[model samples]
Structures are given as structure tokens and as C-alpha cells.
Target chain A: MKTQKFLLTEQEMPRKWYNIMADMPTPMEPPLHPGTGQPCGPEDLAPIFPMNLIEQEVSTDRWIDIPEEILDRYAIWRPSPLFRARNLEKALDTPARIYFKNEGVSPAGSHKPNTALAQAYYNKVAGTKKITTETGAGQWGSSLAMCCAFFGIECKVFMVKISYNQKPYRRLMMETWGANCTASPSTETKAGRSILEKNPDSPGSLGMAISEAVEEAVSDENTKYALGSVLNHVMIHQSIIGLEAQKQMEMAGDYPDVIIGSAGGGSNFAGLAFPFARDKINGKEIDIIAVEPTSCPTMTRGPFAYDFGDTVQMTPLLPMHTLGHNFVPAPIHAGGLRYHGMSPIVSQLILDNIIRPEAIHQLETFKAGLTFARSEGYISAPECNHAVAMTIREALKAKEEGKEKVILFNWSGHGLVDMASYASYFKGELADHDLPQEQIDAALKDLETLPKPRQGGK
Target chain B: MSTFSTAPPSDDVQVRCPRLGHQVHFGYCRAENLGSPCFKALDCWYLQFDVVGYFKQTLSGADFAAAFVHQGRPKMQTLVDLIQQAKQGTPEEPSGPGKGSA
Candidate 1:
């Protein structure tokens, strides 16, 4: 019998988070200040984030210390278990050895707490009394709420009204953790009020919620806003995921040949891959794949014109850049897959060809999720399903080649809260919205005459 | 040809919204982008309900094509735009006086 689970003692937890910025082969450009169109500095971010976190955001120190206070909080869930997917291997009848770092075991039932605790601790240190944020699915909100409770800081979450009313469990979790959850468009701020006055029945949107949250944060000096993903600091805080996995894999006496993580704003994926990316930078040959949903196309395609019908059709053809609505696929059950952007760090890495980004279809992701749930006995969050789908694809490829490849992926979260998506899949309600290859090809042909999009500028 | 029911799921039925990255209801997806249905509404709600069929039945071909077919800038780009808009204390969504200007 082979060893199944690899556990790291609490003492073995990494003390510093890896910052890939210092190690990137080519440095990434800084985010531009929306108004000035110049590289944004710490002062630009000071309105919402604390000085400490902003320092981390701009720091390229390669290693940043995990504060003792944050370490104590992380100890409760740090050193999350790494397990070999022996069962999944048998189920797939593959020769590949699969390993997954279980992030679902965290308090918020996702990997979010890994950074939530760190962000909360930094806010506390900055003398912030309250934090304001917007939540789409409530994962980040609940995680921050729990961490804020531990730190005795007030948390105000402006959840989209639709989710506020429909998905009450995440809100309930936030309330249980002592955070004040408000439905956006609630007349709390001018932004919310403006939308509501226009349409009294507005269902509320993430954009609206963000406006409300940022308004509250900027208005009150003691209140700072926190984002769940898509920032360098957030990715830096999440690097602990991969750091621990490195140690656990050492114990298992195996090294992964391929690393896969589903990318949304890219924090969770970055958390697990940046450490390995460092090794790759130092001449280690490894396949680093960032999985994304086909629904949310990012870092995948450039501007192109697609005619509605066939390869020969030319009448209805329009440049996607001009129309602003070329092939935006339908939304998927995977919440992370819906995000239209990748983290700047991840985006830069893709540009450098250090990381490969692949888009998986909605139906295929769900199918992989079910296969994973049945064999691994843990249902994955829809976002995590993309990684599972890719992993299955890689494992099957290894089988076809008769190779015993080692594969590792981040099990970002459990799907207990997302069982409804699985239910829809079982009911045959899910569909794939990927455009046919011919349509895409025809669209590309038309792009040669169109105006080119500005690259890497605000 | 599809086996799934064309009837819409109850208003309470929620799926993880790809645009917002959270679970949202059919009610919101239908009209969240102001009075018009969200551009992704047909693509998103197709699974839970006969979203494409429903939209086809309710909207003219041009309107249906307009709502779901034409696309916008990437969400990442939109987010960057939102940050600028938010800094200027302007609402990014097209509501109120901001409608049509966007």
C-alpha cells in the first residue's frame, strides 16, 4: 500500500509569503491611477487599503514576513493537508499520481481565509476600526467577517441585492461571525441611492455593490476596503498555500511534474503556483497551467471580428473591439470563471510564457467535478472544477502515454454551499457556450484590417 | 431537441454568477444591466431555464441579437475603467444620468 496523506506540523508552516514580483523575469508594470493615467503609488491606494498592505503590494522584497499575530490565527487552519488522489487514480484507471492541497478545510470553507486573516491583521495594526467590502458569492465576505471577529474589528459587507436575498447562508455566516451585511442599492450611500432612485426594483449588481462599499470606505477614515482577489498583496498573502505544499510533497518523496490551479482574479492559483514558479525560474522544468472558464475569456484571445454565420459569410461581420460584444460566453456555475480579468502578476507571467492559460468548458468542468466528488469523496467548488477538469485531462494523457506523471492542483474549496450547481448538472440543465472554431477563424480573418488595441496601457 | 425544461427556475434559484463571481438569481440576471437584460443573460440562464428560448420568444430577433450577441470590453478592462470611474466618484453602471453616457 502507498502512503495517502501528507501532513505538515504547525511548526513547519512557512513564516514568509513569497513575492513573485522580485523574481519575475521581466517586471510587471504598475497599475495606473485611474485619474492621472500614471503608475499608481501607495498614496493612490491609501484611500481604501492600509499603509501596511499597500507596502506589501508595492514591495518586491521576494520574501515578506508573516506577522506573529497573523501566524497565530493561521495556526488554526495553516498547514492544510496534502493528499495523493489514490482513489481518483484508480477510478480513472490512470498511471499518473495526483495530489491536491485541500484548501476547503479552512474556516470559511475555502482558501479565502488564508489571506483574509492576514488582511484583517494588517488592518488592525493600522488602527482601522472597521472594514468595508463588497461580496459577490459571500466567500470573501464570510472569511473577512470571521477574521474581523477574531480581531474585534467591525466589518461591513455590501452584498449584491440578488445574492443578499437569494443566498442567505453566506450572509448568515458573516452575521454569525459578527459582520454587518447590507444589501447594496440600500440608500446607504449616494451610489446605491442613485441606482435605486432610477429603478426601485433594481436587483443590485456587483458594480453597484462595489460603488456602495468604496463610498462608505472613502467617507469614513476609520473604515478601509478589502478586495478578495486580483491584487499583488492578495497574491503575496496567498503564497503560503504553495509553500506548505512544497514541504508536504517532500515528505511524500515526490515532486509534481505539473501544477494546475483555476484562475479567477488569480489569487488562489497564484498562491499555489508562485512558489513553484520560483523554482521554474531557477531552471526547474515544470508545467504550470492556469485554468480559466471559457465563459470568461481573458489572456486567451486578441481582438477579432466574427460574422454570425459561416466562414464564407461577410455581411454581418463586425470588429469585436468596435462592437464591444464579440464572443462573451454565457456565465458558468463556477463563480471564479465569471471574472473577466486575471491578476496583473498572472497576466505578466502569461506574457512571459512562464505559465500556460487554458480555458475549460462549463459542461466539462461539471463532469470533472462529479468524477472528482465520486472518487475523492469531496465535491469541489465550481471554480475548482476547472482545475479538476484539466487534471483529469492531464491524467488521461499520462495514461495514453503509459507514463507515471505526478500532478498537483489546488482543491480551492468544497462545494457543499454550491451543491445547487451540481444539482443543475445532474438535471441536465448546464450547457457549453464555446463558439465553433470556424466562427472564430472567420472572425480572425476579418481582424487584419481593424484598428489594433493599445497594449499594456491604462 | 434539448431535454431540460424550458420553463424558468423559481426566482429563488441561484447559480454562481460569472460576471459578478457569486450566486445570483434569474430575476437579477434578466434586468441587472438596467431595464435591459444582462448581455450574458441568455448564455448564463440557458441551463437553469430555457433562457435562450425565452429571450427569443420575448424579444425581436434584432433585440435578442443586440442583447446577447454584441460584446463589451473584457471584465478586467471594465474593472480598470470602473476604478477610474469610482475615483472620479462616478457610477460605472448606466443608471440615472449616467445611463446612455456609458
Candidate 2:
């Protein structure tokens, strides 16, 4: 009786990505220099990123035009379908209408390519021949690899070593796309070598891998670094997800009352929720939830302050919800969600109370994944399980309250290639690593040693 | 209830290893795939899954030896060569000098 799927034509795809910074309730705190404690400018970022992306990072413009070339390439997967999870709703038997923007349809099987394609295009235009990056679960690496293949640029990925050992096909996919992916703590770079020497069996955190990739990028003349998340430009490029969903929702004749997305470094969550967050900023009644893993509860447990984005303190200091730059979470199956820090923009939004963050356990998320797969016929990636789990929570809550609520979440990717994690789940081998309050307190104590941010971004 | 802090698997022979139908996650490492740390021979060349600590923890030394398959190119000094040098002792597990570390 109701529309089961909302589809958009390629021509209907948005030409401009939304910039939530323009409509934020308050201005963002400028990123600071670890050395000077002063605000960092373009020169501070030029060594690692192309000038085009740097511009977008600091951009206050409400909308930035997407280049036609990028749009042409995006047409291959752009205008991805929005599905009404009618089956999932029926399974839950709640009065909630569940919808998901299926980002798993992309070639890399994730929403990561939405920004990877844009980053590669900008770097190619800037005449950069090679890009170095870090991947947590290999989603970002594979997506960047595919984008680089289309642009004829070289891609080097430093994947977190645990993920390298856990998700091998994630490596195969990247290699097949013409990228070279190495495990972090390798002898390839100074940063990697030093970390390896310090603790050879170190499971290799995302922060450590980022330091290696950033070192590689800064050392080369023609090489630039690409990040999958936790940066402004990356999230800005990802806004296409929300923009398209807005159109699809209009077509479906319904608007979401609640928006949810899983937060890793926060781009996926910000991408789909920031547009609606704009409405919330303006007196609209909507609930925005950013779900995170209980194992690495940066959003729920960490403090908002200036911290290095990388473990080795090479990146400019961003005021974010950090679980200490050196702190590494246990090797959870959801590798992509293991970052110690979050995006500064998302951190600012959280500070302003524009969004709420909820932590979900690994076991609960896996259960939600299995439930959704059985009902919705799509196996969700482990990192994406957090959002799905939260969606189920809200749907059940609505049922308890006898209210019909519209629930929407970003289905960041599919878990078909990540079957090993699912296999572990089915076998009862996956352990839940809750962040002990003592560990959280120790990590916060580590942050107390760092230079405190100037109060008002002066 | 007090929480348990379990020792992480000595070598990353995670459950995914069997599911992927490979002994290790990145597959048998080749010279061309040195981009990965396991086969780097330069620093992380110790084939972790075949390390003595892991073998003693889960299975037998000879069993791990039999499962060890060499995949690197002929000219390249692979983990197979370095594992032989380590004497397969659990105490020497994490500190293997690898093969060609500078």
C-alpha cells in the first residue's frame, strides 16, 4: 500500500554538497598548531592535502558545487536507492516506518567512495601523482583505490595491522583496484618503523596507521594524503548522501522524525544527518542520534578538547572528543569504528547539543545485524551494525509508547565481504570489550598532559 | 562481576583465518605483496601464526610447521627462512629480528 522504494534519476542527483558549518548554531573552533597553539592555516595542511580540499575544509559557504567530471564518474553509482525497510518494520511489529539510504550499492560496498572519488579527482587536478592513506577496515582503502584507478593516480594504503590480519579480502579488493596496501607498523616509513620497534606485537591502531600514512605523504613531493573521515572536506563531500535522501523522502511523501547513523570518525553519520541537523538547528523537532561502539566510547566517554589526530602527534591539533591519541581499543571486529578521535565538526555539533550520541555493545550490534539480515535481506557491515542496533532500539521504544515514528539511518555498507566477522559472530567467538571506567579515566588523564586549547578559539 | 582481561591471541590467528580458507589473514605472503607487514622481511617478517608461542598455545609445533606454506618469490627471503632461524621458542616469539631489518 505504501511506496516500498524511493528512487532518483541520475539527473536528479544534487550538484552541490551541503555544508552544515554554514548553519551551525555557533562557529567552529579553529584547529590549532601543536607547536604554536595558534590557529593553523592552509600552509599547515598543504604538505598533506591538495589545496582544493584544504579550501573546502575551511569553507563557510552553505553549498559547494560538485565538478561535472566528478558527477560523471559518480553516475556509475550515484543516485543510490533509498529503501523503505518494510520487512524489517514488519519483523519488529512496531508502528515505526524504517528507511535506510543504501550506500552499500557502491562498487567498494561502502559510502566511503562518495568522498574518495572527490578526493582523488581534486588531487588529480592538482597534478599529484600518488596518494598515501590509512584504512581501519579497508573500506576506505578499497574505495580510494578504485577512485585512483579511475584517475590514473597511485594509491598506497597503510591498513591497521589487526585489520590486515582479519580482513584479507579487503586487501585483495584494494590490490585488484590497483592500490598497494601494507600493514601498519611496517618498516616502510620512519613512523611505522619507530612504532614497530617500540612494540612489535602492537595490534596497530588507526591512529598509528594515520601517522605512518601522514609521514609518507609529507615526505614526498608529488604525494598527498587522503583521509576517509574525521575531516571537514571529507564530510562535506559525503553530504551527497543526505541531499539525495531529501529528494527521495520528498518523493515518498514522508520526512524522518528521527535520523541515526553509526559514528566512527563521524563522516558517515554527519553525511546523512547533518542536513536534517540543519533543520534541528532551526527550531525543527527531530531527534538525531550518532551511535558508537561501547568498546571505544570516544563520543560518550571522552572529553572535548584539543588533541593530535594521529598517535604520534604529527597532525594539527583538533578540538574533538578524543579517547587519548595514544589509547587503542581492543581489536573489535568493527575495525572501521576503532578510531581514538572523532571529526571536529561532529564534536562541535555534540558540544552544541545539536545531536545525541549513544553507545551500543558489540554483541548487541551483531545480534541486530543478524536480525536485520534475516528480515531485510541485506547483511550489514559490522561497523554499520551500531546504527541498525540503535534503529531497532528506537523502533521498539516507539512500540512501547504506542506512537508511530519515522526512523531513518544510513546503511553505510554491506557485510558480504566481511563474512568472516559474521562467521565469528555465529560461532560465539567474538568478545565484547566494554571500556572500563578506569581505562577511560586513564586515557582522559593522558589528555590532561597535553596543551589545553585556548578557551574561545582566540 | 569482575571483568576478565583476556590475553589477546599471541599471533593474530583470528577466527577469520579459517573462514578465509587461508592460514593467515593477508594470505600466504609473496615478495610482490611486501607492502603488507607480515612479509616485509625488513621489520615484521616473523610469520606470526607459525610463531612458537601461537603453536604452543593452540596446537603443536610440528603441526604449525606442516601448515606453513611458502608463497614468496624464489629470489626473495621469505618468512619461511626467518621462522627457521627463530628456533620456534615461545620465549623468543615477539622479538624476532625478522630477516633483513636495518
- DockQ, per-model, please? 0.25, 0.04
Q: Chain A TM-score of each model, in the order shown?
A: 0.91, 0.89
User: Pick by DockQ: which candidate is best?
Assistant: 1
Give per-residue CA lDDT, model 2, range B5-48, as digits (tens): 23323333442221112123332221112222321211111222
The TM-score, computed over Cα atoms with residue i paired to residue i, of candidate 1 is: 0.84
**Model 1 docking category:** acceptable
The whole-model C-alpha lDDT of candidate 1 against the native structure comes to 0.75
Q: How close is candidate 2 to the true structure, as a TM-score?
A: 0.77
Error of 1 at A139 (Å): 1.1
